[model samples]
Target: MAANSRFSIAVHVLTMLAKNCDGRVKSDFIAESVNTNPVVIRRLLCSLQEANLVVSQVGASGGTCLARQPKKITLSEIYNAVSHGEIFSPHPKTPNQDCPVGKNIEAILCRLQKEIDKTVEQKLAQYTLQNVIEMVEREKV
Candidate 1:
């Protein structure tokens, strides 16, 4: 399956907003920085806004800004806002029942996937948007 970039893009957008919290940022500028189309950026922004992570305005001077302070937003919130699929998807077809491994593989994988998901959620919760902004600043040497 193709890897999804929604989570990454959402985090990037949030980090940019946190790093430059002076005023609203145009989606065009954000698109240029992300190397993607403005429409894509706008779509992601809409999702963020729905999640209460961002707020947007209209008109010539209108743009987007974070709804809350960077320190108040967690990576877990962004992940849940944009992520659409299982971290580990099951096989498309059912495994053969004759083989013991095949018969039990799905159950094993399902349990493992649940454990991984829990761990990832815990890790993501430990990170805030402020942490990401600080990391980005450190890389600017």
Candidate 2:
């Protein structure tokens, strides 16, 4: 399966907002930075807003901004906001029941998948948006 970029995009959006703490940013500008369309950015923004990770305003001079300080927003929160499905999905079709490995592989993989998901969430929780911004700034030097 193709890897999804929503998580990274959301992080990028939050990082930009954190860097520009003085003001809100428009979706067009964020799309330019992300190399994606403004519509995609807006959709992601909606998910972030629903999760309380961002606050958006509408009007001629309106845009989006972080709902809270960067240090208070964890990567896990962003991940949860944009990721609607599992990181790894099982095969589309069921495995052959007659085959021993195929019969049990799904169950085994599912158990392992759950562990992987938990670990991913835990790791993401350890890094806040501020941590990402620091990494970005350090890389610029």
Candidate 3:
């Protein structure tokens, strides 16, 4: 299955906004940077806006900007804003309760998935958008 890109895109959006030297950046510009459609960036922008991670403006000079400082925006907050559902999807149909392996598999995987999700959340909380920007600064040529 294709991995969901919402989280990564959300971070990219925020990072761009943090470095938004011009104050606000347009979706079209952000989309160009991400090499995806503007609508995709706009859609993700909605979620980030809802989470208060970013703000938008309208009209001739309209665009988007970060709602909080880079240091205050945690990766966990970004992940929570864009993420929905479990890390690992469950079976489409109910597992064969009649079969020993099928009966126990989904539940087993779900337990592990929860553990992983929690761990990921905790780790993400330890970092912030400022951390990403600093790394980017160091990597710049």
Scored by TM-score, the top model is 2
lDDT of 2 by residue, 1-141 (tens): 387888988999999888877888999999999998999999999999999999999998899999999999999899999996376889899999999999999999999988888889999999999999999989999
Report the error of model 3 at residue 4, Å: 1.8
Poorest 10 consecutive residues by lDDT, candidate 1:
80-89
Off by over 4 Å in 2: 98-102
Candidate 1, residue 13: the lDDT equals: 89
- What is candidate 1's lDDT per residue for 1-141, written digit by digit as tens? 487899999999888888668999999989988999999999999999989999999899999999999999999899988885368789999999999999999999999998888888889999999998888889988
Superposition TM-score, candidate 3 onto the true structure: 0.86
lDDT of each: 0.90, 0.92, 0.91
Q: What are the models' TM-scores?
A: 0.84, 0.86, 0.86
Q: What's the lDDT for candidate 2?
A: 0.92
Report the lDDT tens digits of candidate 3 across residue range 1-141: 488889999998889999985677999999999999999999999999999998899888899999888999999999999996477788999988999999999889989988989999999999999999999899996
- TM-score head-to-head 1 vs 2, winner: 2
- Which one wins by TM-score: 2 or 3? 2
